[model samples]
Target: MTISWLYIGIFLVVSLGLPAVAIILAGILAPKKPSPEKSIIYECGVDTHGETWVQFKAQYYLIGLVFLIFDIETVFLYPWAVAFDRLGLFAVLEGLLFIGILTGGLVYAWKKGAFEWA
Candidate 1:
């Protein structure tokens, strides 16, 4: 009974009190000043130019998403391959199915013009 309460107390102290103390100390010690030069956006110690938001083609995101999907799906094949000897035909069939699905996705993306550089 007392042991559980002790653990609860410890958890509360570590999670809540420690963070509160650190934040309060930092706020008290930190400088609070703003100037025109410091207010501007700084990138690589150079003045930033133009609007931060820029228009992008949907094809760029489509290609990136397709690459990610295929890349992650392909990694699963490695573990399946390693266990192929033990799993026999089952692993082979499963891997083929997985590859077939991703290949279909690849075909769809290709047909949709995801692979085009322009």
Candidate 2:
């Protein structure tokens, strides 16, 4: 147990320390140069005219999250489907339950106007 903990501790330290050391090294080794052109926000090689920080509608993110959730359903379902013959009745019920829950979530999102474009 102690050895396992020691390994975990070492792993954590190395994982964290490596990135920190790299960033510190970069800061120390990189050139200290600043200019107006460098500071200004450049988009598609053109100067930005309006405010850079534009607020996006929450619906965009909500729709994206919905897509992500459904997409992940395929990942879980595909394997279960491939092995359906071996898995028998229990797996079928479990898969049905999972689909039912996701369907309920989709219906809820639809009712909330998450699919609306405008």
Highest lDDT: which candidate?
A: 2
Clashes of each: 0, 0
lDDT of 1 by residue, 47-87 (tens): 77787787988877887898799889989889987888898
Q: How far is candidate 1 from the true structure (C-alpha RMSD, Å)?
A: 7.2
lDDT of each: 0.87, 0.92
In TM-score terms, candidate 1 sits at 0.53
Best by TM-score: 2
Q: What is the lDDT of residue 44 in candidate 2?
A: 73
Give the per-residue lDDT of model 2 (tens digit) for 3-117: 9999999999999999999999999999989998798766878877777789989888998899999998869999898998998798799999999999998999999999998
lDDT of 2 at 8: 100
Mark the regions of model 2 whose C-alpha exceeds 4 Å error after superposition. Answer: 1-48
